[model samples]
Target: MWKRLLGFDPATMKVRTEILAGITTFLTMSYILAVNPAILSLTGMDKGAVFTATAVSSIIATLIMALWAKLPFALAPGMGLNAFFAFTVCLGMGNSWEFALTAVLIEGILFILLTLSNLREAIVNAIPMSLKNAIGAGIGLFIAFIGLQNAGIITSNDSTLVSLGNITSSSPLLALIGIVIVSVLLIRKVKGALLIGILVTTLIGIPMGVTNYRGILDWPPSVAPTFFKFDFSGIFTPQMGLTVFTLLFLDMFDTIGTLVGVSTRAGMMKDGKIPNAKQAFMADAVGTTLGAMLGTSTVSTYVESSSGVAQGGRSGMTALTVAAGFIIALLFSPLFLSIPGAATCPVLVLVGLFMLSPIKDIDLDDYSESIPSFICIITIPMAYSISDGIVLGLISYVLINLLCGKRKKLTLPMYIMALLFTLKYIL
Candidate 1:
């Protein structure tokens, strides 16, 4: 049943390989279980509730990807989307978490509708190859930046935009150790290197008085504080509408870009098209919808899924293993959540490097393409938002082509999108 469902032969991908692949994938991305609650708690949400929601949502969504999409991808409350929910909407704009969740719900439904109409695929095809590659590299830098910040290796400076943190600090020192350990294991070609890196760094932290033991088998937090807590009434307001659009726009491109890059690497793309594209797209859409209802941020396909694929995961069996890991995580919340950001920083940075490896394939000699791509690569981290980088790239790509007398290069949809993006700022 497993082989027939996943379309893989035992000779090509054995059960052990798939299980290891699944374990690697889960370990690579499991940091989300801790990170989501930390960010969301800034918005005054219950940390315990967010932790439970994150785990449950990821388990269900990843199961969908394994069963329906039959792809070795894991779903979770996305990092950037969670940051936007906490920092931008709740704290910056002073809106309630309920209002932010409503925006996410709306975004997910809109995505499902667009996917059903086949419009999402059209948008995917519309992006130029150069721009798509740039988006991936840009997101790579964004991920690395997140790791540095999380580990306290990068901190805000009053004079400069960012500056090095005190290397002697506990967090920075631990992060350095983690990175070195992971890098060495990766050089040795260790299976589950990323997972082992996280675990070893965590153990190392214990002696430094960082990884405190809270005892195991504690009861998981109830989702009551966040479950079905969205404020639908806020959706009609102007500020809330913008919030919804922002969430929708960001998730749209991020998910598509991740799917494209990871699939291309896994040899899952043929002739620039993905097999079972609709199923993959729907898996992401359904995950986001369920995540919001379960009191988490947008659930999307994780780029860390690439780590699993690299471990020779080619079927749903790998993803099913990841789902099982998430189910187990619920019982060991204290253990999982106890992992400090410093211990996992290396994995995030290394994953960033993987995401960026495709930039070598871009045609950098063409100034028009290179310039716009550079804008995308730099702006994502600078602006601290992927959607901002994408819009800027689109606008610049159109304007640069027009000025260079290359107006015929872009399609009508590109021009329309540029205009729409421009009007978003004006109106």
Candidate 2:
């Protein structure tokens, strides 16, 4: 596995290189295992159960990536999907945790069906290339915004716009320090720069009394595992099914965008098709369903998995290494919990920056592409929802195309996407 991932004969690689790659992959994805449970815990689910669900789902998803996708990519509960699970499905919809889990399960199953039926491909092909680039940039902006908000460097104002925070505040200052330091390191082409920046910022935060140290000193208490709590009772209802379907589709597109961005970076596309996309989608579907059964939200491939690729990961071995680390961390949740948000926030912000590099190449001459592209790219962080960005982007794309005398460029699937966006707006 090490040989496959590192492109070196396992018999010949320096032990240090192998260890370093493994550690890199682990650190890049460890946040998912920790964050998923923490986010779900907000829904008032049993903390112990949520943790167990996170571990189990991670294990299952990692196994799928290793065995099926066979790519250097780690899958986990997605950041956008978790927010949707928390803010949209659970809180906004006023749904019970069990109901939400049921929705996740149903969505997973539907996702599997969509992949098998070629619907996933249809949807992928339907999206304009420019829109895809915008989606990538938009997600990056969204993630960066999340980091800023978490660091108290940005705050909402009257639900219309977000404004900068008080720079005098310690948290914002620490976050600024982190951002500047990490950005500098990245510009210098430093390897493991993000991790270093995060550690440095976290250490600085500790001295400034911005981060709590109680969790570090107190040994983590072991919590018993509660697995397989599938609750399908409320999921079959019409309203419930629709909600689940919406969540599923939302996660599916989010995953699609990530896969496209990562695969493009890794040269994984052949004739605009990602090899084993079906299998990868299946893995995601199964992982999400399994996550729901285990008592967490939907699990999917993470965009941060691209960080491993950027660090020279070239095969499924990287994902396997990440998965192995997740499994070990599952047994030591307390250790992961000790890493405060301030520490991880820098990494997230840096990853967002790395992901935004593709924006430089997007063609802005064509209004059909450029307008929707700009809207999508800008709306993600501003709207605070990827799905909303996508929906609005697609709608704008169709409108722009019609107005630009390019209605002939509309394919069947594009029409369908536009219709779906319109219906979504109506509903």
Candidate 3:
């Protein structure tokens, strides 16, 4: 029944492989379980209710991605999106939390319409192959930077902006050790190497005191405080255009960047196309729409899904496993939270290395393509944004081609995208 439903084949992806891939994906991203509530609760929202909303929304989104798209990606209220909600929308804009959620719902609806109209695919296809490959490679570096920062392996500097942390710090030291362990296992072709590295790192850190053995079980928090909460009355109020546009633009491109990056790593891209592109968009759209109604921020695909792809998850069964993990986490939050960032940080750094493999495919000979691609690959980590890097690349691609007498190379949509991103920066 499972095989028929998910189209899983032992010859291609074993049941154990998918199951492990699912759990590994969850392990990498489960930080959101605690992190999301912490950020949003600053706005006077109930933390427990936000926690339940985060977990439940993730399950719904991941299941959709698994079953509808038949791909190994997971979805949740996005990390950056949530921050924007708390910092920009709720606090900075001085809007109520309920009004902010309404904005998210509106953005989701607009995204669904765009997807149904084929605009999303058109934008994707308009992007040149060089940029696509570059997006994939850029995301690789982005993921690595995230891991390093999370584990304290990298720290902020007054002059340099980012510099190495004290390696002797217990958390950084443990993460470094985990990196070594995972690297050795991968060298030996050990199966489930990333997952093994994480669990072992957690155990080792317990003695170092970077990890705690939190109790194994807990009951879920009630969602009543936030459930069905929305300020629909103010959704159409003035001065909301920029906020709405920002949410829509960020979520759309964020999803695009993740899809391109993870798919490239998993060898899922073919002839410069993402298979089931529409289904992937639909999954995110539905997740965001339902998520807002459930009292969370915008739900979208997580780049941490790359961890699952690295774990050899090819089918939706891997996604199914991730969904199951989220469901189970409601009862085991303590256990899930116990696995510290020092442990899972290694998976991100390792999988990031895995993602960079596609850079070998980029067209280095063409300066036009190579230059923009170079800007993208380097700027992603430096700018701390995948979408920003892609936008800069796109903007440069259009201007360069137009200036180089390759105006014919730039398509109508390409020029339009370049203008849009330019406007994004300007206004």
Specify the highest-lDDT model's number: 3
Task: Give the alpha carbon lDDT tens digit for every residue of 1-427 in model 1.
Answer: 8866765567777887788888877876788887899999888788899999999888888888888878888888987889989999999999999999888889899989999999888777777777777877887787778888888999999999899999788888999999999899989998778778888998999888767765677777999999989888777899988898888888887788677767766767666766677777888888889888889999988877877776778888888999998988899867766788787688778877877866886788987898988998899889886777777888899999989999878998889888988997888
lDDT scores of the candidates, listed in order = 0.83, 0.72, 0.89
lDDT of 3 at 330: 98
Give me the runs in candidate 2 sitting further than 4 Å from their true place.
Answer: 1-35, 42-44, 83-94, 214-226, 265-267
Per-residue lDDT of candidate 2, residues 1-427 (tens digit): 6444334445533444333444555665566656766777787777766766676677788777766776667777777688878888778888767777777878888888888898887677677777777777787777667777878888877875778889678888888888888789878978667667767887888878886654423222233343555567675577687787678777877778777767765556666677677777887889988787777788887776665665656556666677777777766666655455556566667667766876766777766788888998888778776777777888899888988889887788888888887987788
Per-candidate Cα RMSD to the true structure, in Å, reads 2.5, 3.5, 1.2
**Count of steric clashes across candidates, in order:** 0, 0, 0
Model 1 quality (TM-score): 0.90
Model 3 TM-score (2 dp): 0.98
All candidates: TM-score = 0.90, 0.86, 0.98
Query: What value does the lDDT take at residue 105 in candidate 1?
Result: 89
For candidate 1, the per-residue lDDT at 166 reads: 93
lDDT string for model 3 (1-427, tens) is 6556665777777888888898899999999998999999998889999999999999998898888788899999998899999999989989999888888888989989999998998888888888888888998899889999999999999999999999899999999999999999999999998889989999999999999878998899998898878877776667467778989988988899899888888898888888878888988998899888888999989999999889889888999999999999999999998998889889999888888988888878988989999999898889888889899999998999899999888899999899989998887
